[model samples]
Target: MQRKWMFTFILLVVGFMVAVQYNTVQQPSERDTRDIWAIRNELAKERKLHSELLTEVRALDETLDKYNASEEGNKGQALLETVEDLRQQAGITEQSGPGIVIDVVPSQESVAMGTPLHEISPELLTRFVNEVNRFKGLDMDIDGKRVTALSAIRDINGQTTVNGLPVTIPPFQIKILSPDIEKSEKLYNFLQSSSILDDFYLDDFILEINEPENNVKINGRSDQSENRYLKELPKGG
Candidate 1:
């Protein structure tokens, strides 16, 4: 998961860097369009891989839940308790705690109804999502959706169009769970330091954790690769 985050960040940075210089360095006119297409293709491929991994993770979690339930009084009971606590607190009847809500808006809030398709670019969206992920406990998905490992970088799944309805493009609205105000602010500030924040109006963000909770769940990934990777590393020998 950590590797994927870094990979995604690098991809986003590259995309933005290209977008920044797309027109200025107008020397190679013929290959310009082709190069842009190649970058977008790479982004799509990464999204597909992430999606596949996410599905695997979700399936593994289901299996763990079933096994945990059967072993009622086993040694893993404490772990089960933690999972249950996280789920309930993440969202249930009610949750009273400090959480951050990031509101992402288009470059122009009022882009006239009939504005052309090329009005906003994808790099803007990538930056907004990256900004949210910079925080220790914060991550996001499109609106209420949870970002699984396989979430796509671009809305279309490498397809030009599907069935009629269009895919989502960012300017994403992110909701994050942040326990500490100071740390959360630090993360937000770091994001603003980057030029992406300047491109959009971000006053809509609200960090409301006044109703703090005594406990917050730590819902971890179901992948065993983490353990394997660490065990195989140099220090493990």
Candidate 2:
């Protein structure tokens, strides 16, 4: 009986040891499963971060594209405005403003005396134009022909010509534009007391200055010929 009791105690001890070993093995598998879940969570976070970075990069690219387009558009608009301004400065565009009209006619005395009307001298017209320019004439025209910086006033074959075009006889109009009404009034006042009138009288011509009128139009140059001597220079030359 004593031997059987000892044997039973030994079997119980062995069974407890086996149970502890089995529990240790099972705990390792459960821990490994938890570790795998943790690793998957970390991978998911990394993937989400990568996706957000890609989205931000794409947004930045789109913004950059929009900025480039806007910059190009602004450049184009600036170029157009510059071209228009140049056209205006070159007197290639029609201008209208408050100004005065000058009528050139034979003097009443000369007409009454039955004296033949003489053709206007180029020097007189040139001097008159210079005086008008000095008095703030922004634009001018002679008998409907636009006078520009490049216009040539001279005698061609005994006929007075402006920009190679013939000027009409006496009674032709000389239209001048001022920047504003105030300048127009100033010009009118100056002309009324100017010595240029005496010069006209000496030549048997009447320089009649009219009151300032609004909406005075001066046409642009009809000739579109470019200057043959003016050429664009090469870059870096």
Cα lDDT, all candidates: 0.50, 0.85
Which candidate wins on TM-score? 2
Highest lDDT scorer: 2
Residue pairs in clash, model 1: 50-150, 51-150, 98-209
* Residues 1-237 of candidate 1: C-alpha lDDT, one tens digit per residue: 999999999999999999769865765556545687899998998997798799879967976776666656673765666567655434322332344555544445445444333322334455556656545455333444444333444535442221222334434344545667665566556654665555554422222222322333323322222233434447755
TM-score of 1: 0.38
Model 2 TM-score is 0.64
What 10-residue stretch in candidate 1 is worst by lDDT? Answer: 204-213
Supply every candidate's count of residue pairs whose N, Cα or C atoms clash at under 3 angstroms: 3, 0
* Candidate 1 residue-wise lDDT at 117: 33
Error of 2 at 128 (Å): 0.2
Model 1, backbone clash pairs (residues 3+ apart or across chains), number: 3
Worst 10 residues of 2 by lDDT: 27-36
Off by over 4 Å in 2: 1-70, 229-237
